[model samples]
Target: MASTTDVIAAPAPAPAKPPKRPPARKMVAWLDPLTLVKTGIRSAISATIGKQADRRLLDALAAPDVKPCDVSVDAAGRPRQELWLDYVSDLGDGWNSTYAVAETVARPSLTLRDETGATHETRGGAVLVFGGDEVYPDASLLAYEERTLHPWTCALRGQRPPPHLFAVPGNHDWYDGLVSFMRLFCQGRTLSGFETCQRRSYFAAKLPHGWWLIGTDMQLESDVDQPQVSYFQELAKQMGEEDRIILCLAEPAWLVSQVRPKEGRSYLENNLDFLEEQVFGKKVSVFLAGDLHHYRRHANPEGRQKIIAGGGGAFLHPTHLPRKEAELADGFTPRKIFPSPQESQRLCWRNLGLVVSNPRFGVLTGLLYMLLAWALSVNLGGANVPQALGLVVRTALSNPGIVLISTLVILGLMGFADRRFGRWRWLVGLLHGLLHLTAAFLIAWGVSHLMGSLVDLPFRSLGRDMLSAALIFVGGFLAGPTIMGLYLLLSLNVFGAHPNEAFSSLAIPDWKNFIRLHIDKEGHLRIFPIGLRRVPRAWKRGETAREPEWVADPRDKRATPPALIEPPIVL
Candidate 1:
């Protein structure tokens, strides 16, 4: 070897650096703005003509009432007084979630055979009640065929006499004016062990013990059409004063109290008020709804229960962080008996990444600003276009402000969105604006330093001039993602995370969930929420149907033995 100092000259050639690859494609392709455009178009159409058009024709359509005897009994000795009803809501997404639902469908009798030895031993043929949203992402015939009908049909596996199918139109189903949903579910075609018996989207199923399962059509954000209201009004008149009814609505209106404290009562609340005061004019047993994509059972002191069971093959919604009773303002007592494994931190962190990185709108926003930074560096050098672009990227990175502002804005919007937590929202806004201002200054400073390293363009305080251009570009390109992220942040925080994840580009593998309502021989309704750990891809996974394992909290007062709330106990 040469002298020690000279040995540096013989340093081995550096290991060949690996070539950088373009960023990997997003996990979910449709989670982009293009899909949003398609859905937005459908939503706009529904808002305009679809809702109005359907209103005029409600009465013209038919709603058939199926009797108790029409459905088979739950077990051997069980009388017709007992009924088994399988309820699924916000269904029509994810293979595993639907697979879980299918397993229960394949073995409908298992629900009737409760562990408590609740003696209803007859062969119970359940009526499948879809709490709307049969198919999703526009609800086209293809969606229904692929996501809804085929999946359920495959699950049935030629089992004789499949459950009778009944559904109300959810917001997603209205995307195509319910045309595809009508054809697949409303039309009388009985393929795949399922039958569509109701010509209209809304119906009232006559249950045992003077009970009625009344479902109404809530078209988009509009009111329940006059026809639906009139139909229910008439039905209410015919029923006796003692008859208790289970009201089935597509949206959870009363849950608004969980989010917005000072907001006025929702349309459904007013409708319920009218129904109790004017229509049925008696004690409404339960108010059941799905749409929030989770399970919640709330009871008022007067015994009225508002149960939300939207966990049917959809990403589960995260429950709101528990706050003070005065802060919640919602009158119902939350039954903590069914505590989901979902945590707020995990939900928010995952959703924030998904919302920002996955959406095409968000990606484009990031890239546009990045490109602008490159462009700002472009005119300064005599270097070729490719070389200039690289320099621009380097300069943008040097500034650090671009990334800083983007992150601050996202965090600020998310942090301040909780209305229940008092007036911290203003602090978020103030800090966000200050950070943005700082970013603008840093952009100019970064330009100056970058130019110093390269050939300077013909301009005085060139970096200062660059600030104006940077601001202009940021104002335009950055505005979209900034605002979009803000909107998503507010919605995710306010809506409590589940709706964001359920409807977003990211797919979270949540536990499979549904509910079984069993009317015992005593005419009491017992609701069991079933949750499965995972989907069994093959039939050999288990011999029997899968059911939920209850996760009881010791702190839950309602966790007394048997867990049955005793029906006619009011919903």
Candidate 2:
């Protein structure tokens, strides 16, 4: 043994390791101002979307735990009254486009006071079921309360005895993650002393009497057939003693727009089958909603009724002009003329259909539309190829300048309704004239596009398009708009309230006028004027005019009962 120490050969003298440099100081964390701005926008958008998703639900009123003593068969199994709510939607100006939200909120109180007067007062307290889209734009409680104040405070307070109020959350309510909606509507208070009931965003409520009000959170999720069906089964089970249950949805588009092609990975249309089978086909007694921002009813060919009452305090919506030439567009059926509903009936039903009440949609305050039109007209010199293309897009999207100007012109055309626009008929005339000029330019641009569609742009056509574009630009720059505004106007006989006195109500019609056209699957170019027609339904996808084919069977009725859902009812 070379010696234990030698054997360890040990530690060749540890080579002096170079002194390790101290770890570098950590960099200070920082936030970019641009990033902060982006975050705020995202937060706001998420909030709005949450409202769209909030479905102030109804609890499963079916209680197997009910004491046997509570059961008493009525002399007649059927309750004395059988109410069928035809349609319900957006009673409170549910959704909001940038244009008309202000008007909706301005007239909140008058909108929500159970206008259709209680169907009937029964021994059991009444169930006031809301179709959906209870709050407009966003589910801001302030907005909801504001709108509710007018309706309830003004008229509903007069009810000898107030009936129970049942509400269904629409997309706007569901938008802000439904937190506010759930807080105000579902969790806050509903029936008197019914605080103990589970405060789920969506649920069912049973009147002391035999009626069951089933409200579904249809907005957060597009197709609610399964949920609706499940509610039915549960209702049927609890319905042993209860009379018929009323199935209410916030938006009627569920059935009509059910077949729409899914856009941006959206499942909106796929659920139509479920809706049709469980709710529509199941013969759910009543349907009510408010998304069209106008009150109207389509008595379902199948006995069920569909109502769209988006006309709460938010804004009004108008039916567009009839297309003279029929062109096949998806979802387009020109209802140039429609039978107007009764004012009282509309009020009772919560639709913005009648002339007694309707908010006006407005235009940009800073002459934005006019300026944009002028820019395109002037810079492009009347119709540059690119400007023409852009104009085509604007027209297709229902150019605002065209709509606003045209509306002014429409008001002028009436010559008789001068009271409405007559206050500034000259100004209105000027605006409409400008609007018409813009419209003509836009139409010409569109025509070029149509021509381009028919024939590839030959060099000559290209040259002509370029020349036209330059002329448009020069004209727009000089005149602030083009000549011959292509626009459509609609009669407001149904929803426009005649102002009996100056400053009686909100001065909207004159201050704001515009249109948003939704060219359906048919070649029908239908306009929903901006201020009047909020186009409550946003992000329309698919061919504007074609009725989609049913990929899935919509009438399949086979399914498990809703009461037996896996999650036990917390209530």
- Tens-digit lDDT string for candidate 2 (416-515): 2323343564555566554644544554454444445545546585676555555444433333311211111111232232211111111111111211
Tens digit of per-residue lDDT, candidate 1, span 1-571 = 5776664557779998532421111122345657767877888987787745774264334543422223433336443666777777887776555645664545545523333546332232467788877766677877777676655765665444577778877888988877777677666678567765666777776677666777777777535666666777767766776777777778776664453343444665676667667777655777788876666677766666788777676655555533323321236777642334345434544544543555455555544444444444434324544565465467657766655645565565555444543465556555545444444334434444555565445656656456545654544344544544444455455533323432343444354456667676676776666555444332222222332211222343421222222222323
User: Every model's Cα RMSD, please?
Assistant: 15.2, 23.3
Compute the lDDT for candidate 1. 0.57
lDDT of 2: 0.36
- Quote each prediction's TM-score: 0.67, 0.41
**Which stretches of model 2 miss by more than 4 angstroms?**
1-44, 47-89, 92-125, 188-198, 207-211, 225-233, 240-243, 254-272, 275-283, 300-302, 309-314, 319-571
Q: What TM-score would candidate 1 get against the native?
A: 0.67
Ten-residue segment with the worst summed lDDT in candidate 2? Answer: 562-571
Instruction: Write down the lDDT of every candidate, Cα atoms only.
Output: 0.57, 0.36
Name the runs in model 1 displaced over 4 angstroms: 1-31, 55-79, 111-125, 260-265, 321-331, 337-342, 352-363, 378-506, 533-571
